[model samples]
Target: MPAKSEAQQMAAGAALAAKRGEKKVSELEGASKQMYESMDEKELEKMASTSQKDKPTHNRKS
Candidate 1:
């Protein structure tokens, strides 16, 4: 049996990474589409805030 060439191994690894990245992008797109379709402006705006921002004013300092 022959060993695999370096170029072949690199190509295979790159192809696998590309496939995984594409899957992640597709999932995010689906989520964004669902959110846009289902959420009202107020709800979406509320969701945009960080937890820190949601705390009372006195709880945070500059």
Candidate 2:
């Protein structure tokens, strides 16, 4: 699924980087860390690729 907000997309991007070894998983924290652990590359790619235009910085619901 696509990211619901800019923050979610950012977190997914971080996680995707770690998944691809572009960034260390140790560099992740909070939602990014969780995503790295729980999501696969494709799922993260979908979320990270979601356009941030007109989206909120953060989703209100957890």
Question: Top TM-score: which candidate number?
Answer: 2
Could you tell me which 10 consecutive residues in candidate 2 have the lowest summed lDDT?
A: 53-62
What TM-score does each of the candidates earn?
Answer: 0.35, 0.95
lDDT of 2 by residue, 1-62 (tens): 99999999999999999999999989999999999999999999999999999999988975
Tens digit of per-residue lDDT, candidate 1, span 1-62: 11133332233333333344532423333434454455554444444332433334332235
TM-score of 2: 0.95
Off by over 4 Å in 2: none
RMSD of each: 20.9, 1.2
In candidate 1, which residue ranges exceed 4 Å CA deviation? Answer: 1-28, 52-62
